[model samples]
Target chain A: MSENKTVLYSYWRSSCSWRVRVALAYKKIKYEYKAIHLLKDGGQQKTEEYSKINPMKAIPTLEIDGHIIGQSLAILEYLEETHPENPLMPNGAYERAIARQMMQIIGSDIQPLQNLKILGLVGQYSGDEAKKAEWARTIITNGFNGLEKLLEKHSGKFCVGDSVSFADLCLPAQVYNANRFNVDMTPYPNITRVNQYLLTIPEFIEALPQNQPDAEPQC
Target chain B: MSENKTVLYSYWRSSCSWRVRVALAYKKIKYEYKAIHLLKDGGQQKTEEYSKINPMKAIPTLEIDGHIIGQSLAILEYLEETHPENPLMPNGAYERAIARQMMQIIGSDIQPLQNLKILGLVGQYSGDEAKKAEWARTIITNGFNGLEKLLEKHSGKFCVGDSVSFADLCLPAQVYNANRFNVDMTPYPNITRVNQYLLTIPEFIEALPQNQPDAEPQC
Candidate 1:
């Protein structure tokens, strides 16, 4: 696939978007990054034009090989299958299942609870900023607590084994969000260690929200 | 895998667990069903012994061949990989991604927002029964709206094509939940059509929450 043909609709700080960005970078697949700022202009993702691309109105929609794909996990699976050279999953079926288990723990179980829209609803329902923060922290901490236990058995250098898989792609983004909510990471040494190691990799570093082209200056 | 060796820790009403049951039945995999009541006895899933099996304390934890697996999606993928005869995914990579995209739409986006635990949080935050119901309705309606559009192009007797896939496993359970929360389904004709069609399948019908051995008598 040519570099120019792949376009990713993304936002710098969206964890789901970050997962796709890191996966693309890791696979060495060249793609155009079209930043759809999640917060600007009442959330660009919710606009009519963007909804045509992804009906879910979520960021990190990948337009690749003339097919538009939504959902970061779906995008990662597509990349892993189509671009098989640098595989993002383990070889064994059981091992691959374990890796996917880790991904779902973060993607389905953790991230969705603390997503921007969900947090907004929490704020709306609670009418307290501290309560919203607390809600985020509680979910993140619970997720991490489970993750830490899983990683104790699965971690080698990354989230599965010695190789970097999709689980590794998910780690940094989630840990980034965990820190944003001021969740204590001290209890999860394995996650912290894997996250630290992942950040050092060039692809991961390049995919960091701060390094993205459309990143706004942090407050 | 021997039926005696395979055990699934599940709850009759848990949508995530329901997804696994449909997948297992569809794949013709024999497994022992061990009910872990989520609401009874202060949530049996939170007990110390259950936690040892699944640290996350979530339902539909599958134990087969001495390996324990959590996450409905992961379990489905594992079943697909291990029991490839009755494949739950399409052949082409792109089509597979679309199937997964559909699954994630229900699994990550819709289900998580309306999950029992999240709804409990919403209730706590709102401190009003009406507001809690509204919160559930809003998220489910938003998700169904997106799903309706996607299904317009993707549905063919199922969420992906004219065959059962992981997406099909997710659809029935979600639509079931949508009904429980009283979300207006009139606007989503595609979902309603597909869901009505899915209910006719024997595997799906057998996997209904009310059909499970541990099903409680509804009030």
Candidate 2:
């Protein structure tokens, strides 16, 4: 496995890509970064060459040890299984299910409703920038509201428990997204507290969108 | 584990819930079903009592062995982990990643955008029932398009390979969703093939929404 090269196809600000970046850094797995600009030249991810490796034409596709895997949560599961050192999953099955449940709170509910393509469609459908922003804000705020309630029973130093799990991988990136959309974070103290603490971790810090090679100067 | 009593909080028409039903049937796990009608009395899932058990107020929340698991994909993973009798996951790590990848295509990308809440919002905003239908159709079509392409390299007798995996659990329910929105399935031959084959299986037939106790007579 050491002889195999790991290559990640990523975009700078894609939250899904950020999740994978954090996991790779946490597990101390070395991978070559291949930037796939989501908005450049009508989106490089949509090109035939990139689509060959990732049929979904989405970022954070990992080509590791000759297997090309799309979907960020799936990538997180793969990394946890392959590199158990500095484990991102909790010890037991129930705990691991909780981790997956928390991550899906963002992955399935929040982020999917506010991704670039969906936002673009919203803007196009409404023909109003304010409406688009409102759409994203509402989606994020609603999702975080539910997340805050769930975290009441599960929160410790991190999302599922004291130690960082794959659930933590989704938090900071989503908070960043919430900030981008001007979501009021005051209501979600649990998410805010966990996200703020996560931002200080080196793995998450290095994986921040602003630190990516393709990050814009303003970002 | 045999002493455990499993319970599922579900709505008959939820595509996500239907996925769990198929998996439970395939694995031969016995569970008590408690119906949570999504549209009756302004959606029972939104009630304060239900919210305590499932903060997100979404159906297909699995209560098994004293742990309450939310999120459909997480429930599927928990089922596969707990009931290894008839395995729903593949053998190798790469194959399992492929299984998760395929499910995420539907779970994260497709279904999230077209759920009852989103469609209700679309109908409310646009003030057009047809527009809401269009929204669901477009999302499902785009997702199925990508899924169809990915299935090109992965399909044998099932979504990931010859054997049934978690990926197969998502197919029939989604195909049902697509038809409800009147999506033309002719373009997705791979998906059409796999879905039709899956329909003939006994577990899937028994898990059909029409077979559920709470199924609407029209459905």
Candidate 3:
């Protein structure tokens, strides 16, 4: 049988979208990349068509093997289960669980707080751009501080081990967002050290926000 | 060997913790519930001791199989992987992906926006209790609206099918929180229907916030 036709709906600067991009790249899976700009036209993700594809109106929804899936973690899990050659999860259940814990530190805890909707809400409530940015910084800083501690215990050239895993895929995008928010990296030496190392790897680099097809230079 | 002492570090009202509680119950795995009051003693989760257990200082950190898992999703995954009895994940990769997708809609997108940390921040910004609650209402309503659409396509006595899966574990807690925020649930009938049915099941009912050992009646 022929290969499955794959399509990834993504937004360049979205940490969750960037996560799936890295997972796709790491697995060496080829797909048609469609940019769904989060901005422009009042946020394309909110469109009715996109909403049908992803009920949450979120990005990095993968259309593959005759079906679609939303949620970056779900997309990543699908990729791992479908393409097992370059497994991102560790071997044992305990090892994999800890890796997922590291991922959730970012996925569940950090990025969601800085998501566009909340930031907009916070900005409206604060009535100040600077205060909104501070809110993002605080969220990212708290998460990175905690993640740094976990990395100190788990790192071996990567978040979980020397071999790059799913947790590794989650890190660089978060570090990028952390940098965007000016979250001080000095407090997170291990996180900084690991993110720096991951940047040298092509699979991770290619999935970066700046490298996406619709990427624009940040002001 | 003897059953591993599974201690679940949880708080009564935390959505993430409640998710794990249901998963443990659905799997019929017995565990010691260690309540860490989120608001007591300067937020017990922030203590140095607790930070060592979960750097993110988040609840539903399951201590099992001689290791600790810091995220509810991770804990749920570990339970599924280890026990494999009355499995919480559906069979088939595509089916499983959507199940996880449903879980993430609540786990990653919905509840995180209404978390205590973000709520406190919003409260600080708004300088009023009513506005903070309003902010939560907006977030939950938006998420439940999206989730309700998804439920229309996937629901069959449980999220993703007739069987109780990981996604089912995330819903009741979220609906409980939605009720707490007075989020108008009339718009999402499917979610309301599924939640009502889930509450009838003992596993879900037993894990409800009001049923928890530390539950306190609302004014």
Candidate 4:
């Protein structure tokens, strides 16, 4: 399980993929980035080759120690556990749960609702771009509403207390997606403040979608 | 921080709530079950009082030690950590990650897509019962396809190993959901085998939605 031999199957715009990227950067773990272009050629992720690597047909599958793993949260937990040098979670059990609570709010609640396939399904059903965007906005707004309240109780410089935890790893990515969908951030002052602070962190900045090798230029 | 004094805000049919219910039973943690009727009066989860307990307006909110926590996975992690007597996660980093991988596959991938709000959105857009069911079946099939592959490599008596782990905690609830959506389980032999085995377990059987105090007989 050598860190140097790691290879990450990632796509630039994938918020889930962005999560593992940030964690790897924060831990200063070197790995090969195999860009799986999600939009090109009807999604490279859907290719038979990539499917063998990740049966879920999702982005951000990490390969380490001859073992391939999927699910961004699972991969993040693995990294945190195996490489405990720069911790991404808080120390205590209760505090760690709080961190995970925030992560799940974004990861499970918000991101899944606005995922590429889901949005596509929305568009297919409604045949309206506005409706699809509205769907994304509604889920994001609901999730952010809860996140704002959580941050009020748990934030200092990050999503949970003074340290940068797993919650912080998920926040910026989801917030970035929220902006992409034009979900108003002004309603979430605490979330906005923490996201603003997170953007200044070197690890967070390095893992931004724009900073990735496969980032497409905004037209 | 006493286990006996806990209160779980749950809904009978909610798969997420079922995850926690089974965990509580497995750990022998005595807790009060506060049924929040999700469908009654336009969802009690959306009520102002319930929102105070969980700002996300979601279920399986566990209250203990003056702290209210939402997100089923986080709650399960908390129970595993705070009460390590009946451990849900296996020992060691790699093994734990595998447990989490299975949990996330079901928790994030399958369950969220088939959640009540998502199906509601599908119905609202398409106005087709078949489309709604198809949407659910599609996601469940995709998730189960991956899960079956995972189980083949990582199953013994449960989803991860010989002993029940966090992965097992997530499986039965998700399998029950898959059954509810009419997803054919025959194709995934591994998932069916595990799900069948899980149904025989006391904890899983006790946490079945039909066994809950708030259970309503099928019309």
Tens-place lDDT per residue, model 3, A1-219, is: 124789999988988988899888888888898999898999999999899899888887889888888999999999899899988888988889888988888998888888887788887888886787899898898888888888899898989878777788888888887777887888888998999999999988899888989999989
For each candidate, give its TM-score against the true structure: 0.97, 0.97, 0.96, 0.96
Docking class of 2: medium
Q: What is the lDDT of residue B95 in candidate 4?
A: 79
Alpha-carbon DockQ of candidate 3: 0.82
Query: For residues A15-85, could you state the per-residue lDDT of candidate 4 as single tens digits?
Result: 99989999999899888989998888998999988887788889889988667888999999899878899
Error of 3 at A10 (Å): 1.0
Clash pairs for candidate 3: none
Q: Candidate 2 or 4, higher lDDT?
A: 2
- Interface RMSD for each predicted structure: 0.9, 1.2, 0.9, 1.1
* Distance from true location, Cα of B105 in model 3, Å: 1.1
Whole-model Cα lDDT of every candidate shown, in order: 0.89, 0.88, 0.86, 0.87
lDDT of 2 by residue, A1-219 (tens): 233888888888899999999999998988888899888899999999888877878888998977889999999999888888999887889888888888998999999999999888776666565677888888898888888987878889898788898889999889988988888888899998998899989999999988888889873
* Chain A TM-score for predicted structure 1: 0.96
Which of candidates 1 and 4 reaches a greater DockQ? 1
Cα RMSD for predicted model 2:
1.9
After superposition, the stretches of candidate 3 with alpha carbons farther than 4 Å from their true spots are: A1-3, B1-3
Off by over 4 Å in 1: A1-4, B1-4
TM-score of 2: 0.97
DockQ each = 0.83, 0.73, 0.82, 0.78
